[model samples]
Target: MGVMNELINRENVGMLAKILAEAAPGSHWPHVVAAASELDLLSLRARTDAVSRALLADLRLLPDPGYPTAARAFRSALTAAGFTGWILWPVSEAAVTLALEAGSGADPGKDFDDCLALLAELTPRLTGEFAVRRLLAADLERSLQAIQGWTVHPDEHVRRLASEGTRPYLPWAVRVPGIVLAPEATIPLLDALYRDPSDYVRRSAANHLNDVARHAPALVVATAQRWLSAPDSNTAPVVRHGLRTLIKNAHPGALALLGFVPASIAVNGPRLDRDSLALPGELAFDFEISNTGPADARLAVDYVVHYVKANGTRSAKVFKIGALTLAAGETRSVTKRHAFRQMTTRVHHAGVHALELQINGIRHGHTEFQVRV
Candidate 1:
């Protein structure tokens, strides 16, 4: 895949300028274009901020310039100019910057509320998730109160944003300290959305809860329990995804909630096909599990790879091997292959690595292997 920074490059930046020029006639499109032209070596976020600053300067020069004026221009761009996609990133950012600036005025509350609405509108074009962080940080209660109403919004995108935008650890988005301080703050939003009819919205709600689980596992388990109690057709998957982190850590509450309880069982070798492999190779293994108890046992089988880090320490990463049910005294065997390909997200070091099996939140069957660069 192409680097994410390339998404907001000079070409798309010029397109954004052209669209903004159409939306608001006589604006300095050239200035925005020039700003992007000079951005040769900026990261994705830095490029977005630089372009936003350039757009904000132009927005300020509009007739009777202010947040309202900028909002109107953006609306016109969406409706009249038909602008959309990655190009809208800087547009949304500029609008938010203007809105936050407007928050220092006579009615900061109204400005905050208005900005939230603008974000809802802009979300359908391009996510306002990153932009809304500033507003949430600026006024947590007010912004959340406004977002609470969005759970019932007719549009799925807006409903998704209601949960996605408020996530405590939303990737590629700024941190909202208030969210971390009050972990339970966004629970109400997730509660309203976890059973949403739209998979799109429910997915966001699931991810939001997962983010919460990062800091407060109990809170997530509790929330998930409540969701399971009054579940709809899609609630099970939502809860599973939401509790994924907790499940990986083998949290008892999370495992039990998904019916992956402790059971009398026996595990055999995660027997390796080979003990050593080179880069771009695969490690194949198999394991057998027998339900030793009289009762049937449901299992959530997963594997952990203890990778050799650059500093010679090992870091464990979990990978899932689908779930299954074992009848009374039943035994099942499974085989899996894991690739050791170099990825941008992970570096391969020449050292001893290990693999282990996890079943129903329990670890079993350890095996070590050597990797060569």
Candidate 2:
């Protein structure tokens, strides 16, 4: 089973139940386990969602387990279970689910504050991103106000969530169309977090900025340039990671901002061990790079494999091989093997395909191969 499938298995469920039972002995957890166990684990989403719902229902069984208070009770349970400094624990989904459940049933006038408090408590453990998105959907102005407050929170995790939760393209969560439409709104939060003392917070800020760059490339490039102008240790990496998508796409503005100028180099003797391979086989290829420039050349060596689709269209996937500063008159030889093993995401198709070597976003050489299934 994959990592997600294994995360909430029998053993994990028992641990979670024990933790809950210990934290709030009066709150029945045995029934929670029973309900959650019936969920189908055929896929990660189905299992997580089903269990999240089951957990929320089981919490409702408690005698007047109040909002925000119950969320705090769960947080206490996590800490008692020795999960105090951990982020994204196995039981995180349960906390997030409970937050969403409470928020969904909240009375806008009386329960709003309590719901936000619950989300604040849950954000550090698993994530409040999904739960916050629901609030944003209901009231963008109010939800954003709450998120803005978290930007300066004493807890780095809460500050990180301020940026991460509002991301337009947060992976594994539903996309937020509003953010894409107005990527500008998230800028202030990211700016507040760009120089966060915590690497964890900084990484989230970078990723959040990268999501904005997807919709507003020029804006993000400008933002990165400004951030890099006063480069600190934290901001430098944040800028690099934030501009990663733009760099990968070979956006000229991003390339110029990063100073990954085109270099003078020559690719020689592109050779494949075999021109064809069957399913479950691997393809090995070799190539040589010679620096022809008079000065040292900083190079980002990467390869792209153009895979044939079922309809005869081709999709290219880029993989980074190495990054180095090659001295003048230097030559380096590289060998790489690509596996055609079956995966849940990719299906092998028998056809001729193309491979290209790219140096600092410049294609250096091209070759072809065939795959037979």
Candidate 3:
């Protein structure tokens, strides 16, 4: 089986940027941008680095060739350039700062609306997050109103910003102090985009609400129930995704909702290695589940493989598997696939390893095993 190689060295990113730049100067930015995303997982921590920050600053100064599709390239470039502190620093703060400073307080009505309009136009291409931060830093009411106004815009992109801009722990974006301050106000914005026609916009709403749910479980649950109560085609999926974290790890209410029951799911069993069937090998596993429900569900499975490393350090790798659908009264059998496979660099040593089954992103059951090779 072919393994997906992890980005350890930045050979691809560095080389691709140069190649693209030489082949197509106008589109080189995107190449660099994609390279950055490709390398994001390899970084030791979840923040951008200093060199990446410098790149963003430079990219911001370069003039665009004025292409439309190339327009998104700007935001992607900004994201790529952050390199570090992308999520750590407040991005929206800087944008709103620029917006406010560019405005004249003397004319605050139509002029303010026009000013916001300009900001909205540039929003997809600019930064947002620290938007709440910037709002609090300057004029709170005005900033909130602007974001609220953005929620109703004809553009799906604007509506998306209304939610994404407010997400807590938004990656590479700064946290908004305002969200922590006037948390209730954030609800209206979430509500506006809750049933947005665009699935893209809806996902943003789900993520934002999920972030809020961490802090206000009751409020989030209430909002979720309000939507789930009716099972409106639109809101159901939104509610499910929004409540993912709560559902996962089996929060009491969520567990009850899912009708979870504890049973002796795990059974010690042995199997012959289809490959050799020569030496005595030990592997532990367990299971049984079928939706037999009304809807086609996307289930998430979680597992952590524990094995002794060649360096003698005990280690583990957690992974996801099998997002499939089973109709009502349907029988779907899921075959177990190893997340972390036999590696040339790592040897299997006798020790303990753990695995868990997650339904809809929630961990409903778990088991452990001893493997020796």
Candidate 4:
């Protein structure tokens, strides 16, 4: 994974320098490249942010005295490297972000304008989703106004960024408390694009609503119901995705909105292949399920393994097995394998662990197993 990111290393920096040297021969390309190459890329936690920050620091070393000068030099290099279209997405993203990071300490009004210009030039190919958040954090009203304008932009990417950038639960970015405290701030933006013709834009709007759903479940459910109620709606996919977390957690209102109410279920023979197991072993289990209802049933089957933590307490981790549609008198058998191997994300402790069968988020049957380290 890290090897693929070699595009952000010394070699790529040299390539970018060569382009800048051509675009503006007077700029100190050699000095900039050397300074940037010396940055401790291995020390930075994330690849994109690290490479961007390195470029920003190196641009600062240029003889240019102000943010405008540095930004112009970098933008010139970007144009020289054929960054206008979606030719090199990752490269364009890193370079454009360098422009934003370069102006972090400059005047707020100027920096905001610069970021908007850069996003217009490079977005869709290289998302300004993460970069726009800085402005949101700095000037709430001004940034919100700018993003509202973006919702109707002709560019699909810019329109998507309008919703994506404001997402309260956007991964790899800090949470926006403003959206959490007053989700109404995002309603207009989401509403504007709910029926957007572009899938890209609609997906972001749905995801933004989903994030709000975590903090305001009732609001999201109501919004989804309203959208679903529209005479002609294109929001089904979006609403389904937005309600995913809620559906998995079996929120009553959410399930009712999605028409996925729990059904009566029974589990049989849910026993491990072996009651005892050692480290680096595979634990296998099989089960039988039957729907003894008068009508067909829709079931979301899952398993919960109560892993014994280091402190001797057990923590339950739910793993999805399968979903089933069973007739009134239908029966089915299900089998699954759980690997008990070493993993970076989990540590196994020796103990008897409790495992249960969950049908539509309701616990049905329990089994026990012993694991030795």
Candidate 5:
């Protein structure tokens, strides 16, 4: 597989140079091309920032060397279909950087506001999600006030950007400290967006809420509850996705909201197919559950694998085992085959491991097994 940094390489950088050159007839953008040579040692984000600096340098030469001039040039490029795809990553970055730099001038607020507008315009070409972070960090309330209007924006990408750009832990994006410090600040944006007609927008809204759930579980649950109370057809899925982290952690409120309420059920052996296994192998297991309660019960069945880390201390990771509904006195069996392969995200360590069952947010049986790496 190609590495991520390769996404912004020589060919694409030249494409960007050609685009910018076309956008501004008299201006040269050799600097944008020069940036590609410096990208070899940089990570994906670093490459983006480096190219952004080069782009900004080129943009500064546009008759007048400030944000208004650069903003117009960007708009002209958009009109000419000069900006699109991965190339826009650095273009958006340069726009945000210019906007922040301009914010230090006499009319700081206007620069910031204009940058937000530029981002909205650029989002459809490629997300301004990463670029918007600098503005949020610079002046959060001002940025958010502008972004709140985006929840109802005609463009779904812009609407998604409103929730996605302000996410507390948006992946591959910088952390906006103010958003983290004041988690409630962005909830209103999410409130308006969770039921968006566009699934793309709704998914971003759900992921945004999931980011918040990492640190503010109660707040996430409360917001999810409110959405559930006044749901559209897609609300349940949105809430389920938004509450995924909480669900994995087995948060009671989250579980109950999704109808995986606490129930009286009998769990049989999580019965391992083998008590010991070699590395790069598979561990098969099966379990049976019976609803012993007087009423029908819903179950969110999941498995927890307590993997032995490098330090020899086991960290528990939860894996989903699908959901089911059982009539009172009914029984069902579940089988799962878990692979013990080395992953880039997770390294296998040879030691004793344990598998446990979680049904309806409650831990059931534990079965210990040995792993030979």
Candidate 6:
């Protein structure tokens, strides 16, 4: 389709008719132009399935030292195509430059890490493993060098790309674990990004750490606590976000850090036996609290579940009940409904999966039951 595929600049989109008038048979201009309108004229990635695959093929054609319009077009194409698009990664570092130019947040598809893959080819990470591993570790070193130097470029977009670009899992690009399983490996890069001054860059640093936390809780917790303790204005948000999961999970340390406690618990209905009772389908709970102090109190009660995920990893999650005011000697009942339809899916292979009730985010009551799916 000649280069009609590459007219992706917001300014050039105005010239779409002239470009589309010359589309060869099977050309992707009409679709790319049409889709580009739906996505911000300068949107980050391909939006629809057909458009993604079409752009995927077109993106492979351009080499590095990309033309602006072509580079932008290639970004959408690769972004939409996702992991499948990055099959061309080793051969073209050009896409990385284009991605760097875009400087947006995460890509849209399941294969977002494809460009990150190119960085792996450019650097040596101790844990360079990724969803679809095809590159040699040696090739990644050179690419990493180029990426580091590009950090100093004047374009905020490009600078954002430097940090947002390296996430092990950039969601939609590709799912990799350069930093998730191995935090130490990504530390140097994170240090560079933490003080970046750009909220965009700082946010990226935060998200990357948050992603790492899901798989490696301890690393994220430690990192978050360290950041909270250190006196750096830029890192606070990143650290707070990183610790959010842990806080929700009722991590002992996190509860202690925030000085959170289960002040009062009021449960309605039958008190559950922790050893032999399992919530089936729909279960209900009611809570009431009495403010024992002189001043008004703000509080919350969470329903904590020891979930056995489809993959069998047991974890806890908290759902908020909002803030409440309880003047002294005032007790108000809070109603809650705990749905157990999903628990049926966790038909365990034995052992106990605990369900807990918390007041002000701390565990106060619990019930357990057997499930075999």
Per-model TM-score on C-alpha atoms? 0.95, 0.81, 0.54, 0.79, 0.95, 0.49
Each prediction's Cα lDDT score?
0.88, 0.73, 0.52, 0.71, 0.89, 0.49
Sorted on TM-score, highest at the top, how do the candidates line up?
A: 5, 1, 2, 4, 3, 6
* Backbone-clash count (model 1): 0
Assess candidate 4 and give its TM-score to the true structure: 0.79
Candidate 6 global lDDT: 0.49
Regions more than 4 Å wrong, model 5: 61-63, 104-106
Compared with the true structure, the alpha-carbon lDDT of candidate 3 equals 0.52
Q: Which stretches of candidate 3 lie over 4 Å from their true place?
A: 1-95, 99-116, 126-133, 136-141, 257-286, 290-332, 341-352, 358-366, 369-373
Root-mean-square deviation of candidate 6: 11.3
Tally clashing residue pairs in candidate 5: 0
lDDT of 6 at 216: 71
Give lDDT tens digits, candidate 5, residues 1-373: 1488787887888877887677777878878889978888887788888998998887776678888877877888886564687778888888787777774656767877998999999999889999899999998988999999999999999999999999999888889989988999999999999989999999999999999998889999999999989988999999989998888899999998899988999999799999999989999999899999999999999999999999999999999888899999999999999999998889999999999998877888888999999
- Tens digits of per-residue lDDT, candidate 6, 154-247, equal 6544555555555666654554344444555554555667667678767777777766666776766666666667647766667655566666
- Cα-based RMSD of the predictions, in order? 1.7, 3.9, 10.2, 4.2, 1.6, 11.3
Report the C-alpha lDDT of model 2 over 2-98, residue by residue, as the tens digit. 6666555555565666677788766766555874456454466666665565666677777775455566666677565443322223244555444
- How does candidate 4 score on lDDT? 0.71
The TM-score of predicted model 6 comes to 0.49
Ranking by lDDT: 5, 1, 2, 4, 3, 6
Model 1 Cα displacement at 129 (Å)? Answer: 0.8
Q: Which stretches of candidate 1 lie over 4 Å from their true place?
A: 1-3
Which 10 consecutive positions of candidate 3 have the poorest summed lDDT? 270-279
* Model 6 stretches astray by more than 4 angstroms: 1-156, 194-198, 232-235, 261-286, 289-301, 305-317, 321-356, 359-361, 365-373
